[model samples]
Target: MKICFAVFSFLFFSSTSVFAEESVGISVTATVEGHSYSSGGGGAPVPVPVVSYVSFSGYAYPAAKVYIESDSQNVASLSAGVDGLFSYEVYGITAGVHDFSIYAQDLNGNYSQSVSFFVDVPSSAITNVSNVFVPPTISVDKAEYGIKDEIKFSGYSMPNSSVYVVVNSTDGSLKSFSKEVKSDRNGYFEYAPIANVFNYGAYLVTARTLYGGVFSSFGSSMDFQIMGRTSLFASRPRCSIKSDLNRDCKVNILDFFVELRWYKKPLNKEAKKRFDFNDDGQVDLADFSIMAFYWSR
Candidate 1:
């Protein structure tokens, strides 16, 4: 690309000599006036309306020949080579703040001043908004009485500023338990609800900007649920030496002798329930046989 630029420059300068018999030469120079934006009339900081300049006699160019451009593709532009004045409106531009520069090239390949403007698009209905990230459904600790349920809430913001979340019940009632969060430099945010509050139930969560005037319409909503905890010991009875159906203290084939001896006796229902190690729910020959099958291993 550099080589192409060099070749193009060489051809362009050589061609200018034919237009002016006095061995003419063309070069580019530009200045972005003030090098920054001004809050016009002290009302509120608006986007710099235009980049203005005066050109010295270098090359006679047609007014319809030059074009003005901005670094950002979305920024608007206009060209007037007649008086070297440029005015443009950056349409659908985002709110909060922005920075951009403007430059133009003459018909004869001479560039004018490059003026950079720092713009504060400010909050308004016409301002553009964007949401860069929407956090995934975060897992909350299953609810156990007296234990806190904690889950993080996060997402990104454009023209990043304060963010708000509305925690709602499954029935669509607005929660008094809502909170606000701030976005990071990279548009990241983290929020953990207070402990001992949320219970096991479905929830609907929605997001919005605190400065809604600028970013109200850019956010989305999500849903999540906190479920009840299951006890590990609830589904099975405690094991014991005598309860070893196979007569192995570790519960193998050796315990089968004791089980066979007391098979007809009044067996503990809990022991019988747990002794169904084969998981068929019947404390019988099959359970004993399975224990014997894996006894040594």
Candidate 2:
């Protein structure tokens, strides 16, 4: 399979490239900006009402419906291409700090999480928003599973991309399973795990997509209880495991290597906060031991 990167359309006019960084649904990426006045504005220009524009380019499921709203009002929408790339320009936008919310829905009815962020629009200027990533949506077949029941999961990611599904127990037993599956041509994927979820009081399942060079954070989690042919009410929230430094829902060699880089080395504030698993203001053997305990192997 061939991987494609997003291609941006550069404007004809010369402008200063003043770049800034902002995070989308999952992780941080380039949100570059080419500062320039509106098409109607001249060297010394006046504020033109409804003359500013905002251009957005990002990735979503191929042929998916991408929608955007400004300050809770539907402003624009576009469809992603076959490579899951989408570029849209919203014209006549009044300049100011606007709250823009974006999301995507694939043809198979998978809906990504709504990502909301603030954009400061310069008067009569063009604001460009780039590197937006739409997260994959996930759902399960049932809310309750019997001991012998098979676990089924379905979601939509970028076409031909890999979907990682993870299951963890919250009744405190730490029984878990993690697997990766590929999406079909339409970015639709389904998985039925072979692992038996034994002795589970409650389990939390979530999914994320890895496409091209990027992946998203796990979407809405599904909570199901292991009942003995009887319906029961049981649910409690499970926060992300701190030991999983990479946030891939597993503490394996990938995580081990991530923490290993800082072993015994002076940690930056961010590294100390994340890699210092023991919270003792140091990255030592104890931190690695904690990661080993939550290895999820």
Candidate 3:
């Protein structure tokens, strides 16, 4: 009986040590659901799928179990095959960024090294998004323009983030373009609209931040318009009187005269814009007349 027990112990140790010198390693990956735009070939990054793989040096089977945990929850369990290979599948994940980890259990219940990876889940909730940003918000500190003129633009975004400004007409015609600007560490960016590209009309202005690996949420947008001087005069606000070039206690024909006086001289762009009330491309009689027509209000 003692001899039989000794032989059994030897056999058990030998089987467990079959691939002891071969070594084993594991890897994992995840697939997110509903995270891609049909227009784009690839889905945005999503929660990584929990996949575990065990590799052996030889044909010996893996004498171990694989385990996976996410957010501290034990989610996967599987036994390695004879060739020391294994895998796990995870599902029913939500949209957003999530972290995952993989682990291995030896025959002696010894836990192996743990590995981690990141995944980003694109939100399908926000539709019609042109692009996503890492630091997803941009602020346009100020935006204003003269009558029949395009708006001046400037803003801030995540540092190193690429910012784009697109202006589209109601008819889907893209006009008045500008190049992307890289933000500084302070998250500041500044850009202007292509002056001659836009005519007097309503437009959609979209500002975005771009990133790689994991896509950010879509950017924010606002509606803006360009109009001739007549429109500005008609809608002149009470506070704008301070900008009266003619000092008429309000902005009117006299301001047009003040601008006309400098027409032949080197033109002051701001003065010309302020007095060129009609925005007829040229600040002449048309602008003066438009200003006169609305001089009182």
By TM-score, the best candidate is: 2
Expressed as tens digits, the lDDT of each residue in 174-214 for candidate 1 is: 36456677754433455777434666655655554443233
lDDT of 3: 0.45
The segments of candidate 2 whose C-alpha lies over 4 angstroms from its true place after superposition are 1-51, 230-297
Q: After best superposition, candidate 3 residue 45: deviation in angstroms?
A: 38
TM-score of every model versus the real structure: 0.29, 0.58, 0.31
Q: For candidate 1, give the lDDT of residue 213.
A: 36
The list of candidate 1 runs beyond 4 A from truth reads 1-147, 173-176, 212-215, 230-297
- Candidate 2 per-residue lDDT over residues 82-184, each given as its tens digit: 8888889888777677877677877866556656678767765567787777777777666676666676788877789988888788765875677899999
- At residue 143, give the lDDT of candidate 1: 22
Stretch of 10 with least lDDT, candidate 1: 130-139
